[model samples]
Target: MKLALVGDIGGTNARFALWKNDRIESVRTLAAAEFATPERAIEDYLSALGLPLDSLSSLCLGCAGPVSGEDFRFTNNHWTLNRTAFRNALQLDNLLLINDFTAMALGMTSLRENERIQICPGEAEADRPALVIGPGTGLGVSTLLPDGERGWRVLPGEGGHVDLPIGSLREAALWQQLFAELGHVRAEDILSGSGLVRLYRSICALDNHVPHLTSPAEISSAALAGDPVAEEVLSLFCIWLGRVAGNGVLSLGARGGVYIVGGVIPRFSAFFQSSGFAKSLRSKGCMSHYLEGVPVWLVTAEYPGLEGAGVALQQMLDTPNAA
Candidate 1:
């Protein structure tokens, strides 16, 4: 069996799938809290499917962490994976590990026309670069550069930890509060799921209200239900997302457009469409004109990382150094 196995390992959940050719044959997910390591999660997923691990011909893993040499230590989880151990344990002929964001960037090629909602309208130059950023356990960043032959090259980035700039007086005050607590604030500090809660707490504190805030889901739900405090927090999140994305766009010169992916934005797509995201994106003083013409899209595809892992696996197989 020419089987291809792909995994998207996140902090809370690990999604595993078996792919034949370009289509997924079977998919399963497990709670990260239930497993002690990536190997355990993979074994459990395969066991549930009644499949033998030896049947896999090619394996690719997209982990939510930095790939250092041949090993990866997850940022949000306690799993530390060594490529040698993974290969030896699985007895696989070929195995590849890539950053989850890079896998997502590779999967962009397979995105359907309707799977992405264009947030900004502009002329797309086929030769220009495309951007991808998502907020999940943390912020994931990657770029797709045109290879000039109907192909794109995926470049994974660590842009989430970049210094966050204060955009407004409100944002500046929030930064002061955050800085007082954490001393340093990164983009992830104000743009992730946890960041939404932090923003909500900051707003509540600023308004002299009790700082007893709920989870990110509750905040989103309340915002959708017209709660002023939740709405204010969500609005700030969206605006900051736009500002950070615009910074990425400027740095990449991504005239092909930007794609927003992850588990966060899908929940508030309607509110995001109406939020000050576009306004914040185009607010760059001198470079406002340069960014105004760039298009932005929100990726609405389910299992995007799974598809992206498949793409990454295929690319590895096609590369000369693949073994």
Candidate 2:
């Protein structure tokens, strides 16, 4: 078995690890803002390992943006990599780049039961498509299509930028408030880390009161500390997550299951699980029965992206016509 460098690169953090013994080891997390470029971060991570780059078989990175061939620009950051630059920088031919969400979806194929907390343990029919959506710096969405013996094929998309739905008066007022200022509000506008703050601000605006700008972490902390406003904002975030997830379930007919993992939801697992999330997911009238049977779970595994990157690399190497 060859050792490989694997990474799950997102807007806020980049997780890197060495793959060996069919798992990720030496996992390291780097704040994206601390490095000037992704290459710099990679070099730093590799340096900490005290290993020569020549010993690594390949570099498989799952980026936050769409991967066009070997070129990619992170969706939430300013780093962009052209194929020539990456190839020259790494000096490896087995490089594989995929959407970060896609990498997460790939990781699900080998998910252990202990790694997830069940929201709805509906009939988990194998071979059915699975949906994985996470909210962090931005909302990430991807699907796992059953690809027979080869493995699960990842379909990554910019689903987060889609239209947001307002089902209640409170939600309607928030949309109106957001739309008045931004001219448009995508699902990500209120579903991500920054979105959590935005939700807080919008809630304040709706109440005709001013709000102190706060980070998502602050809001989460405040919510856990029993701040009514913070709790409301967090509740709304969970509510919308359920709504957006329900929409995905409808669009993909994802009967296999819906796995919710990401920066935001995982941090507030108890709140999310007990919030309106499950109810919202099954609230699709007429189709509620269809969705009720579709399971929704929260992936609690650490370093899922690293695990996924390993899976992707192994699959690529196994391909008969791998480049």
Candidate 3:
């Protein structure tokens, strides 16, 4: 069994690791901006490990964007790749590219007890689909369903770009302002890391206060410190996240469970768990019962996408014809 390289590439950082014996090793994270191309970043990672580029048999990446055609451009980063160019450049035999959230959804299969904390308690029905979503540099959404052969299949989509759903007068007022300012208010407009700041500023605008927080981290910190304005921002973030998750659940019939995995939510997990997320998720009129008994968990695994990339790579290797 030859070693394979797996990566989880997001807007901010690129993480690489070696997959061997069904585990991850030689894990290294590189800032995407530091290198001109992914190949260079991988080469640096390999060089630090005292390994040659040819040592690896294959490479699989979970990137933050759509995966298609011979040419691929990253959604959040400046790096782009031509499949033929990348393969020849790396001198690799096999290469697989998948949606980062697809890998994230697959990562759910490998979560341990401590890696996940339950946000909504319910029974996960066997054979039902599970919803995997996260908000980071951008929002990501994917679905996971049992393959009936003891394996799992991932269905990836751009669920983040959907229209922002409004459920209350407060949200409607905020949405109106966002629409007037931005023209189009997608869910990602207020559901991502930058979205936190946008939501904060919007609330500030509504309340006639000057904005104090500039970044997601600062806003979360202030909220945790009992700042009223920041607390509203964080609370609204969780509520909106719940709305999006609930909508996803309705679309995919995700009765298996919901896994919220991302960089932002974990920053203030305690506040998130205590917010109106649950209420908003189940607040759908008439169809509210559809969400009953579906478990929801917050994933805190550091590198689930890396592990998931490895899983996807192994599956491809096992079935060469798999698309």
Q: C-alpha displacement of 256 in model 1, angstroms?
A: 1.6
* Per-residue lDDT over 1-323 for candidate 1, one digit per residue giving the tens place of the 0 to 100 score: 66789988887788889866776658888888888888888888788878787776788988877777976788688888888888888888898887888888877878888889988888777888888899876788899887776556787778889888779998898888888877889989878888888888878777888865578899999899989899888898888888999998899898888899988999999899899999998899999998978888899988888888988787778778878
> How close to the true structure is residue 299 of candidate 3, measured as C-alpha lDDT?
96
- Report the Cα lDDT for candidate 3: 0.91
Cα error, residue 292 of model 1, in Å, equals 2.5
Computed on alpha carbons, the lDDT of every model, listed in order, comes to: 0.84, 0.85, 0.91
Q: Estimate each model's TM-score.
A: 0.93, 0.92, 0.95
In the order shown, what is each candidate's alpha-carbon RMSD? Answer: 1.9, 2.2, 1.6
Candidate with maximal TM-score? 3
lDDT of 3 at 168: 85
lDDT of 2 by residue, 1-323 (tens): 34588998877788999887668989999999999988788888878977755566688998877688656788787778887787677667688888787889889876788999999868877888888998877888888888888587987888899999888998998899999978989999999999999889989988876776489888988898898899999998988989999999899988889999887877788888789988888788888888878888899988788888889988988897885
CA displacement after TM-score superposition, residue 3 of candidate 2 (Å): 2.6
Give the higher-TM-score candidate: 2 or 3. Answer: 3
